[model samples]
Target chain A: MTRRRLQILMPWAVTLGLFALWEAFCKISGIEVFILPAPSDAWAAGVEFWPQLLEHSLQTLFTTTAGFVLAVGFGVLLGLAIGSSTLVYKGLYPVLVGFNSIPKVALVPVLVIWFGIGTVPAIITAFVISFFPIAVNVATGLATIEPELTDVLRSLGASRREILAKIGLPRAMPYLFASLKIAITLSFVGSVISETVASNSGIGYLMLAASSNYNVPLVFAGLLVVAFLGVLMYALMALVEGRMTGWAFRGTDLMS
Target chain B: MSDPEFHPADFMKPADFMGPADFIKVDGVDMTFSRGEEEVHALRGLDLSIPKGRFVAVVGPSGCGKSTLMRLLTGLAKPSAGTVTLEGAALRGPAKGVGMAFQNASLLPWRSTLSNVMLPFEIVAPHKRRLRANRAEYEARARALLKTVGLEAFADNQPWELSGGMQQRANVARAIVHEPRLMMLDEPFGALDAFTREELWSVMQALWMERGFTAVLITHDLREAVYLADEVLVMSARPGRIVHRQEIDLPRPRTLEMTYEPPFQAHVHSLRDHIQTVREAH
Candidate 1:
């Protein structure tokens, strides 16, 4: 009981400790609110601008989710294509890696020129930044199929399509779910970067606007919301992942 | 001789009738795998014939192409030099009536034990066509097979929840679920503990006796070969060929106590001696 309780409480305790240290350091150093606001100032700003903050939060969520959905659908299909064939994997993998390495921030300007100063650029940026992990993880899952399992299927006279539907896709679930956990955060980063650079709305734009007005407390509040949403989405992914892939990582307590 | 364009299922025999080539035959088959710039011969002109419903074991030293032979027999790999035929027709792609198990159970983690056992029904024909229409019947069949392997209670259990021996039992259940004409087991019991291995030997013995599915087991253990097989084929090292064939004359439904008898030990010793000589010949 104690071990389980500790496992649950340790992360929360450390998080509280880190916040406490940061708050104490800013206050003790006699830093001005304009320079580095304490946690209390940020909290007050959050409560004061709750309605505005909530609206901006929803906007960011909408764009990020839209982009992420596109990434997933595109990633899985592309991953299946790349993983199933040696020729496709070799021919396109280098180009994909090269594209991923070129920062999505650079693509934001080009997208803005195409779509022109709106949520579309942010959504596109989010998708461009995050889709790589999903593709790579899924391809890895497909490519690393067990030789024994393949032999088992092949010797039974299973067709190529049957093998993919039955074995390849199911085996890729853990990888797919794992990639979501990583890609969701990147999507958020992509959205915020584009928003800050050239968007009319969202928490990123709000932060950029507030910083220009010297509302350091509001800026910190915006930062806090981004972190909260990132953590929330990650925790949500982890929960769904636990449910879907219980057989892979956790063996004992499984869904019936 | 190599026929690069052998057709699949071209054998002119009915699905269920006594034919001239009633059993699987590997005649003049050779396997050579390429490594970098050089070609490495694994099996050379291997010829063997297995009677229907017979239990056969192939035992040889490491790198003796035992696994290569299994791949060829199951149509996973083409023999470099010769042909493999079931009922006198050449095998091209994966054979229609074959099932295989390996040292590891290789069950899909996401599937329940029953689902894993019923996997082949979703792929192999006749069953594939009837799967959706006869879902409950297939489920019942899977449950019955699991019961045969003493895994009836674990039908809904995740594969990892089962013990190693139990997992192997599930593997055996899965292999036979499709009702293949021939079952290939490549070192299926090699990973189990001595007690578990012997226990599974009994389970397998009962299965074979009841169903009488033709079995071809590849193993390094001479004792296991002698205990389970009606005939044990010994092979030489790389570029291997069948060096000796020993027929087990001991009676049906073999018990573990038989391994302790003077005759059983004598058979094991003689086979071991031949395998050792074959290994040293390289």
Candidate 2:
């Protein structure tokens, strides 16, 4: 392997080694299954409940994906509209910050009451949690164009709409993608939390059921699924970002 | 053996060369800017008339309002008083015939060099309205312009991939790609190294000579001012106003060897002395 590739792989190797040691310690200590199940037990539980686990995992995935898509659509549009206009930014920035400040989890009870104890509340929760980052990042990106570029465009007799499309939107894409990566994770977290509190399906509900029944191995299984889902979602967003911003990476250290 | 009271009629001020009807005119313009409670006058009753196809350079020190003059000419800012006109029409906003470049190239990082140069056509029109219908033509134009700057090989490269000098070449290409009648270059080569700067200067001179577009170049480098400009206007500091106007008597198709000659050195020394005197006076 190349030196750089070896360096990146070393951390993953260490993490795996640590996990193996923990599994061995649990097995040797003869820990009670209910108190702290061994990694083997958790893996066994995951295998045994594979069908149900997959279904619950897909439920969480659907809600998070739906919420993330909506968040990106609305957030990017709102950001562009506000960012393009100095007056709109001045008038609406405070209101946006104020709305973002109200802890999104606090609205869960109201959402459940309104949309009921199902996918709707989870989706709403995901949207609420994920939208702000996309909006803030996109606005920042749109507003931060270099003065020289603007001058070049202005001198060329380019219209306002041209500046928006050619310079503004293309320039803002990197920021929007960075925000998407953050938003996707938040969307997953929001869906899980909403499901734990008031949902009848999904991995979060499965975790709650396992905990109440003293099924520690099953609980670990659910946690592992959630972690896996988060990574999967993040990877998807990252892939999209990489493809769109391929030009931005050409000479930078990030290209590797 | 001096010929006294013999002046060429064509040596009149820029204002007199224009017919009553012309393409662009800057008449009796004054610009003042306020910084908090303090008011600073930038241009004081400045009068300049550019005929349709002339390359004009304005050289001055840092605070002499050269940039302010460019901003005013491009209609980025309104004069505190007086008028800037294009084709006998008052300029309320940026005119449709002007293109600009600055000291820093400032190509957008997210765009490839080709896309960055193609940006003007995509944004402004006659081209903008027809870009969708004529995408291949516009792309061809962008490629051709990039080739002119020796960047056709690196068309897919982003701004950061290129060297500072290369980026500035792209900047110049981007400025003129839309075929603007009036090109405003605000110290576009200021950030480049000596060799690269000289190289790009030749590239710029060639572009201007071939295209035959009117140009307004703002620069602090006197040699650059002398080498490229048909006429150079020097301005005084602070409440800036044009103090000296020198007409270059050098032959066209100027080469770097001309810059090393006695006449060129004499012109450079005279401009330096004038600037020094203005500085000391201020």
Candidate 3:
């Protein structure tokens, strides 16, 4: 096969191979469903509870996407400020680092206490968790513009605002998209964490309820849905990246 | 192969006087930068002048602060002592309507070659305001210039799609498209291989002859300096100042073959000798 064809097929082959190995291991070991459900058991349970699984998956997706959209809007503005100015960057960077270092899961109860057990807390958690990467990446992109390029613009009497608008933002777009891929996954993690801690719906809550009832196969199904959603969102991000900033990846296989 | 229009009498006289006709004047200029705690003196007591529409090249060894001089001339930097003036007015900040091209092509990868050439119109005044209304006219001019550089075919292509020589051609096109009164080039062909660099010298000559803009080129290549400039200025080592000045009174539109001839070789050799002396004096 051609390299491009192999590139497309390789991931699917590896994933299928891993699932086959898992099924073989479970069969040989005669593992209990509660201890480790087989892929077949998970698939069977997923089909039986298809409606419930769909609803919960949709809830998780909604909260993650809502939170992610807000994060993108707010984080990009903060990033532009931090990146363009020395004062904002120095003042906020250490505080941002400290804030990012604090385990976001630890904030769940405080969010729950303020907002109560539902989508609100989950959305807030997702927003807080995802915004940091987007902000930092955008700032880094703006700050690292080539000096020679800056000279070309400055010599033409381009204002600072013009430079930021014309060159800095477009240059930062690839960085922004790269960070979106990371932030989207993190948003899912944040929403799910909130949901499991205190929520009536979502895949996280379903998994928690399934574990309590010893429905290990159902819990495995929930995990699979979340993983599928994360991969789908990541692929979407990569597609947008390819469309918008393909020039940044010229001469690279990534664009193809 | 000399045309009847080629005037040997004009090439015979050297440019020795500095006044009235001078477009830019740098007098007793000094540039010092504080790196960490120590003050590194880049240029000291530098004095130079360029006549209007003259193409002058500054050549020196590495770290001789040739770039510092260009910065001063372009109004990107202020001298620690003395003054840099254009026409007669002293520059307080970045000079207006200056076009610059660097060693790196520095075209925006996001913009196509045609769009990159038209970039100055988006930044420069009057033009920036008139661009939306007269975009077709401006675009036609950009296409014409690209044709002169032999890059008209690649105008719609992305900057990364072009080879290094082609990208540099676009770079030169972008620099001149705005029709600025003054142009600064910082080793604009330094990164190219010998053949490409020589090829660009002809392209550069054609452009300058057509535009008649005052140009200041900073380069280490003596041949490039001699090939492209009306006069070549050599700088001393650190705490740099002009140590030698050679007027290259060659005929217009000099060919690449002329570079191998004795007259051109003599100019290059003389510059090389001056640079050697400057390096040893360090």
Model 2: lDDT of residue B204: 89
lDDT of 3 at A185: 99
Query: Mind giving the per-residue lDDT tens digits that candidate 3 earns over B81-112?
Result: 98887766666667767999999998998999
Give the true-contact fraction for every prediction, in order. Answer: 0.88, 0.80, 0.82
Alpha-carbon local distance difference test for all models? 0.88, 0.84, 0.91
Clashes of 1: 0
Candidate 2 local lDDT, A1-256, one digit each (tens): 9888987899689878877987998989988999888778989999999998999999999999999999999999889978788888899999989988988778889998797898999999999899999988888988898876776676666666767887889888889999999999999889999999999999999999989999899999998888878887887888998888876566555634
The number of residue pairs in model 3 that clash at the backbone is 0
Worst lDDT window (10 residues) for model 1 chain B? B1-10
Judged by whole-model lDDT over C-alpha atoms, candidate 1 comes out at 0.88
Tell me how large the interface RMSD of candidate 2 is: 2.0
Best by lDDT: 3
lDDT of each residue in B66-92, candidate 1, tens digit only: 999888888888888877777666777
CA shift of B60, model 3, Å: 1.1
- For candidate 3, lDDT tens digit of each residue in A156-213? 8887888898899999999999999999999999999999999999999999999999
Backbone collisions counted per model: 0, 1, 0
Q: Which ten residues in a row have the lowest lDDT in candidate 2 chain B?
A: B1-10
- Two-chain DockQ for each candidate model: 0.74, 0.50, 0.64
Kindly report the docking quality category of candidate 2.
medium
Residue pairs in clash, model 3: none
lDDT of 1 at A239: 93
Among all windows of ten consecutive residues in candidate 1 chain A, which has the lowest summed lDDT? A247-256
